[model samples]
Every structure is written in C-alpha cells, then in structure tokens.
Target chain A: MKRIEKVADMAKTSRILAAEGKSIGFVPTMGYLHDGHLALVREAGKENDVVIMSIFVNPAQFGPGEDFESYPRDLERDAALAEKAGVDILFHPSPEEMYPEESDIRILPGRQADVLCGASRPGHFDGVLKVLTKLFHLTRPERAYFGQKDAQQLAIIETFVRNYNFPLEIRRVATVREEDGLAKSSRNVRLTPEERKEAPAIYAALKDGARMLRESGDPELVLGMVRNSLGRIPDAEADYAEILDYPSLRPLSAESGEAIIAAAVRFSGARLIDNILVPLEGKTS
Target chain B: MKRIEKVADMAKTSRILAAEGKSIGFVPTMGYLHDGHLALVREAGKENDVVIMSIFVNPAQFGPGEDFESYPRDLERDAALAEKAGVDILFHPSPEEMYPEESDIRILPGRQADVLCGASRPGHFDGVLKVLTKLFHLTRPERAYFGQKDAQQLAIIETFVRNYNFPLEIRRVATVREEDGLAKSSRNVRLTPEERKEAPAIYAALKDGARMLRESGDPELVLGMVRNSLGRIPDAEADYAEILDYPSLRPLSAESGEAIIAAAVRFSGARLIDNILVPLEGKTS
Candidate 1:
C-alpha cells in the first residue's frame, strides 16, 4: 500500500521488482475508484507478484468541451479501496508530473478510431493512447489489467500493444455493473436525478438489442429497435446504436461469434455509453 | 554475433539479458556500415556489457524524391563490422517484421522536428521516431547511440526520450569523417564520381563558417562567408548555410556557449550536409 508520485521513482521501483524476477501487473485508472477499478486490481493481485494502480485523470483524454474540470477524483478513497483489493503500489501523479512538457506526438488508431467514440470526441483516443503509452513505459508491467466497461478502449490498447510489439500481456476484466444494471463510472455521479433515472435506458436498450439479436438473426432490425427504444426515453439523445464485431468495433452484418450491442446517449447534457455482448445462441460448449 | 530478425526474438533475448543483469548498448543504423556507424558501435561496445546494433533502412524516413530504393545495404559486411567492433547482436528485421501492420500512430515533435530535414521530408521524423520508438521498446537498451552528423535526428531522439521518460540513456557519438573532411554516411556511396570530388566543399564551407565565427563573433557575417565559400564550388549548389545554436538548431544572434555552422548543399543532384561546433572564444572551463 505504498504511494508514489514521480515517474522516475515508479520506474525505479518497478525495475527492482523486474530485477527480482517478479511479474508486475498494472491497472491504470483516472482515480475515483469504483467496483470496476477494484475488479481490475483484484485480478492483477491474483495474477502477478506485485500490482500497481496509477491514478491519473489525464487532461489529454478529455475533449475541449468535455468534463475535464469536473472529472471525479478521490485519491484517499481510491487508495483505501486499492489497498483493500491488494494493490502493492498506488501511483498518484499530478498533471504537471504526468505531463511535464506538452507533447505533439500522438498515437492514433487505424479505421477503428474513426468511428463511434472517436467521431463523437475527436482527439480523445489519441490522448488516451498517449497516457497509456507513457504509463506502460514507466511501469513495464508483465501484464496490464483493463475493464471491459471501456470495451473500445480495451480493444484499442490490445491493438496498440500488438502493433507496437510492446513486451507485455493485457488482461481484460468483465464490465462491473450495479444492481440497477448501470455500469460503474466516475461520471455516473455527475448525472442529475432525472438524468440518472433515464440513464439506465441506454443499458436497457443494449440489453434489449443483444437479446433480440440472440433470438433473431437480424442485426439491422435489432439495431433499429435499440435506436427506437433509446429515442423514446425522455430527453435521451442517442449518439449512435450499433451491433458491431467484438474488439474490431466494426459494424457487423449479422450476429457473428460474439457481437457487441453498443450505444452512447446524451441525457441532460451528460453523455452516457453502455454495451453488452450477445453470445452465440447455439454454441454452448 | 547473434542476429535476430523477429521482434519476439529480440524481446526474448532482452528478457534473458535483463535477468543476467547485463546492460545492453544499442546502435540503430540504416546499414551501409561506415566509420560513423562503427564509431557509435565502438562507443556502445566500450560502455555496455551487451552491444546490439539494428541495421534498418527505414522506408518511413525517405521522402517522395529521396533515395529509399538505392539506400546502400550490405548485411554480410555489416555483420562482420559489428563482430569486429564486439557487438553481441545484430537485429536485421525486414520492413514487414518492423511494420507488420500499417501505422496510424505518428510521433510528431513539437518544435524540433518541423525544420531542416523535417521540412524537406514531410512525415519523415514521424517515421523515424515511430521506428526508433519501436526499437527502444523491443530492445530496452541501457543506452542507445546516434552519431552527431545527423544533428537534427539526434535532437529529436533526445527530446523523445526525455518527454516519454524512456529509461534508456542516450549517447551522441561525434561525427566521423573521411580523410577529405566529408562526413561518413551510407549515402556517400550514391554520389557520382564528380559529386564525390566536390563533396569536400560541403565540409570546407562549414569549417570556414566555424573559423569566421571563432575569429569574428557575428553569425550573419559567418553565414555570408560560408554561403560565398559554397558559391565558389562550380558543381555545388547551396541549399542552406547558416550559423545556429548548436543543440536547439535555432538561428543564432548573440554569442552563445556552443554554436554550429550547419549547412546543406546539393552537389551533382545529391544533397550533402555537414556541421562543426565552435565553442565561444574566451569561455572559461
């Protein structure tokens, strides 16, 4: 349960761990720890000799109009939760520490980044990739843990690791949700009471679409139904609703191996996104 | 010397080397194996327990009209030279091995990469930085060496390592030269017989500019003298001849610590460049 700030300090600590033949498992987060983040920490604790969780609410990832200033941060609470989850180290660096100098270098995705979240928030994934790259270099983890809640992010990270030939393994944890089917997110606290009431509709739409896709072999029809369901929610503005191939984020023609029914909707000025994978119906082991 | 082509092989080798507590020294070169590259290898061999050299004629660094296809390469000769220089490994990866998938991630330098060779070759430094970044990640060298002949390239790599917080040390090997003062380069093989005869003028002009700056501390006056000196060579066409800050490469005005007389000249359709640093006269040790 040690806390560190400087990049050099963290790198030195990680190097010692690596020198001792200990495999490091890392979970990079933007603080405001929820069960989802804790899930990743727990997974890392199980898999590696040492687990590190970095809390950096990276300014690079937020778009100009996005809620960067209002992004939730609770370092003390996060540290306690991470310690409970058996994290060995908490890397909590300030923005100035994380980005000592402005970077013009960016990591952009191929066709995958041009659609969905990328289109909605330009330069967002580039920022994400940039911080992830820096953290990866600093940590040099044997395995890195990421939650499936950020499914597209996980996919892009996997692509980045493969494409860059990064010497690390990536482990994706399942999306942690609340009893109300709401995905655990720091931004969830920003939702107004009315917005909170309507927020679950986004997830409901995804669930409905995935169930329909599993029952019927029509992707377009299921997507349309999800759109219509989201459209009917009070003040809920659907950014996009599509059933896409797992990981690639490419739009799928029909229900293939494991298709993702993903959607982003704006409710009371807060953009909420959710997704559920529709498992292949007749492929039980 | 052991030669590895695949990134996986290099990573495996690096892991074993790390386990043995051996420091890896890396020299990344576009093979034509001249004295300049060997100088770097010699430096690496002296400083590190394990010396690794990569001979990749990166296609990404060449512009549309540049000599990418004709970039001289002789792996057998390079392997022998590396072995002679006591290199432990020579990584000779194919373009496919390095770039298995097309790269959309570009490492754009903020201030350093947009001038000189960068201006002449768009997306050139992005390619250079990307490939070098990949190499750094794969090799995880204790220190990496680059010749000061490509001053701009050296500056870019320095800035990258600092900004990205890469753990490797950077060593700038002094520029190696031919007997006639021509900077040693693989591209020197591409020069026609007449071009070869006139290539010395590039260095001559640089030396003249350095002499002028040392004798008289006026950058403008030094530049004029160098320009006129290059103008004397009948076959040589001056591209840019200016006195600037040694490391930053910004145009100089007042007396500075170390100033460079950097110039690029086109001789017989082959662009040649050279620079010499002049410590300000009367500066105390």
Candidate 2:
C-alpha cells in the first residue's frame, strides 16, 4: 500500500484519480486498528476502485484530562492490517501537518450533537466533524465507511452530508466484536486483566436489556433490571445506562416501537461503552 | 451557456467536466449581476476551461432584522450577464434547494469577523463562511474568484481555505466601479435618489485616505483625515474609518509597513462599505 502524509499530496493524487473516472472509498480512523476498523476497510474496498484509509489521533476530539496525549498508536501494525484489508492508500499525517494553524471555524451539528457522547464530552463531536470534513474534501471519495459502534457520530455525519450537500455516500457497517462478545475498541487495550474480565459485563448487560425487551416488551422494566444487575459487578462503576431510539439516539418512551440498549461503564480508569439495537415488538435492522 | 436551477443537476455537470480533465473556475454571488460580479466572472473564465457562477442570496448571511427577504434577485438578467461574461454554467438554486433543513453549523471566524460589517450585523460572517464552504464543495473548482470590494470577506475566505486545506486557488479581482466612483453592489438598489447621489462619498473617503497615506506617510493622520471627511456628508453616518494591515485586517500603526484603508457607512437605511489597499514604502504586493 502507498503511504501519503501531506494534504497537498493526497489532493493531487485524488485529482488524478478523479480525472481518470475512478471511484474512491475512504475509511478514517485513529491508529491502533481493531476488528471494527478492519470491517470498515473491507466494506469500502469491496465497492470502489480505490480504498483510502486515514490514521489520525486528533487532539480536538479529546477533552481536557482525557487520553489525547497517551492514546495508543501502533503505525507498523496498523499499516499491515490496512494493507491486508486491501487499502490502496494509507494517509498518516502528523499533528502539525493536519493542524498547521489554529482553527477558529468549528462545525456544530445542532440538536443532533446535544445528547449522548456530545453531552458527556463537550466539543468532542466538533473535532470529529472538522477532521471528517477535511478528509472528505481531500479524498473526494465516492463513498465512506463508518462503523455502528459510533452510531451517534454516524448520525451526525449523515446530517452534515445532507445539510452541506456533500457529494459522497456514507455507508454504515455493523459493529464488530470479540469472540467473548466484548466490542472491539483501541481503548480496550488500556484495561487491566481484571478489568478486561469485567469489560464483557458491560456488553452482557446490553444483551440482557435487549433480551428482556424482546421477551417482556417493556423498555422501562428491561432498563431497571439491567441497571440493577450491572451494579453487582465488583470493581465496575456504571457511568450511564438507558434505552434510546436507534439512530436518533434520543431517549425512548416505554411505548416506543424500537430502541437501543446502551451503557457506559468505568473499569480501571478506561471507559467502555456498548449498545445493542432491539425492537420492542418488531425486529430492528 | 447552460442554466441549471437545481443544485443536483449542476453538480452532475460539474462532476462530468471534472472527469474530463477540465479545470473549473467558480464565481459565487447574490444575483443582480453588477460590474464587480461580471469582472470576477471574466477573470475566472479566462483562467479555467469551464466557469460556473452561483447566484444565491443565502438567508443565513442576513441577520434577523437585515434585508434577506428584500435582497435583490433577477435570475433572467443574471443568466444573460453571466453568459455575456463567458460563464459556462449558471447555478441558480432556490432557498428550499439550498437549505432543506435549518443548518445550525455556523462557521464563525472569531477575530477576523468581529470588526466592520460583522460589528454592525452579528453572526453575519458565520453565515457567509458556511454558505461559501457549501458552494466551494459543490463546485469543486480549481480556482474561486471574489471581488476585493469586500476586503474583509476576502481575507476571511483566504484564512478559511488555508485552515481547512481546501485544494482550490482564491483569486481577488479589483473592485469594479460606476462612472461616479460608487462601488457596484446589489444593495445600491436600496439607496434613495438623493442618497444615491451621495453614495460615492464612501469611495471618495477611501481614495482620500489612500492619497493622504501616500503624501504624508503618517498612518494616524491619514485615518483621522478620512474619518473627518466622511463625517461631513449629510444623511451619511460613518460607522468606522480605520486603516488596518493588509491581509491580517488588524489595526495598523504608523510604523507598520503595509496598510489598507477600510470604511463602512450608513445612509437612508442602506449600509455601504468599501476599501482601498495601499503599498507602503517598503511593502510590495
């Protein structure tokens, strides 16, 4: 795979590809690639003549006292994974190259970013939207792949593309997981062995909530049962757990037809978040 | 010349031209086709294989009490003028097409937008930046043209392009004028007959400021004299008459090398603004 660094170089290469009438698919990520990232790449590689991936540990997405400086980065391994996944170009730009000057203009996604992760970490989605827009413009890709693990981000990006009339298709891929049902995340590497054992508890709680909704058909009862069960896991602190509308990420009522069982837990200082989409009466895609 | 009323159709045409290895130049305007706009179109047409002009009186750029609804628009006349100026395509999207939903994403240029026109109308530059970004992405032009009459706007757009890494060149064309020396603008239609007669005072003030700087070589004396002269016009109120550094748009001192005299005035409920760039003793271009 070809590795590019400068934004100018990437734009020039994409210009030539566009001139040749070739379609490009893009997958943007922070380093330390996992199964979820690989799944996005495979989906992008299947639909376009060229597949491009970007690995940027964006500082704007992290808040104060967050993991901005100590975020895990393994370029050698990440590049190998991307190449095996059929990526044609891997863009690895340094912080200086990506943000040469201070940015005064920020892209805010109205009410869409006013809840969920946006509510918890202020200005986080603003950073994501900025970098995503820059990458999208630089690559001019025909399609972009995003995983369901970041469902809120995917929804905000969808609003961005529609509101700005961006000429690209956004494909949402299913969330990938480990054999033990723990959602794959680079942050999972930071968990201690004991915390790792309890990390699966978060996913288990989500599954329990989903299963209860499918069986009892009461979202409130399912949420209360999962909340009570998650509190019993020793050394695990539940940050937030609730039933929300699938893609909208809004709090769902007990009478809602479809909902997502989402939860965030703090285990050994590493925050783990997971969710499962389940229908109250019918199946949710 | 081909005329497209829908953004989607224009984008399709732009995409086809890009695929054919043609360089596209863009000129975005708010219709009514003044000499200044024609000058920009001619300049863009000369340098590009295909030239596209968009006439959108973006509502977001106007304040709640500003003249968004009364903004002058004549698509038929604008199309003829664009065609005469050798424009290849004219993109005229309606309000609904441009903004299907309310966009909360505001592109505010903090310090750069907090002066001059921005001072009088809050949130004005944010709207300009947002719409300009959308237009830039939709056209994907190799070069975009803007009249230097709106000097601060040109400066903000330059910074936006650099900070965002937009792979497009920005060309600043000289301000076009009428025989009476008043700068060409659609807002000129808002001036009463008597107010129209005195409208040239805005340009006169800029020229007077430029001449004083050239003769006395004292930035303070030049700015004071211009402010005094503009204060003399009847029914014309001077908003601000300051000399600032070129490109940066910051207030310049007597020791500064390069400066630009920018001013804004209001007469008969019509706000008028203009600027003139002066190369200092040591500065060139």
Off by over 4 Å in 2: A215-217, A253-258, A280-285, B253-257, B282-285
User: What's the DockQ of model 2?
Assistant: 0.64
Model 1 agreement with the true structure over A51-125: per-residue lDDT tens digits:
999999999999888889888888898899889889999999888988987766556666677777888988888
The deviation in Å at residue B172 for candidate 2 is: 0.7
lDDT tens per residue, model 2, A89-171:
99998988899888777777777777767788899998998898888878889899998787778878988887777778899
Write one digit per residue (lDDT tens) for candidate 2, span B1-285.
Answer: 988888788778878887888999999999999889989988997899999999999888899877788877788888888899898888888988888877676666778777777788898888888888888878889999999999989988998888777878899999999899999988898899999998898888889889888888888888888889899888899988778887777787545667889898888767888899988886643
The interface RMSD values of the models, given in order, are: 1.9, 1.4
Clashing pairs in 2: none
Name the regions of candidate 1 deviating beyond 4 angstroms. A253-258, A279-285, B253-257, B280-285
Q: In candidate 1, which residue pairs get closer than 3 Å at backbone N, Cα or C atoms, i.e. clash? A: none
Q: Supply candidate 2's per-residue lDDT for A130.
A: 84
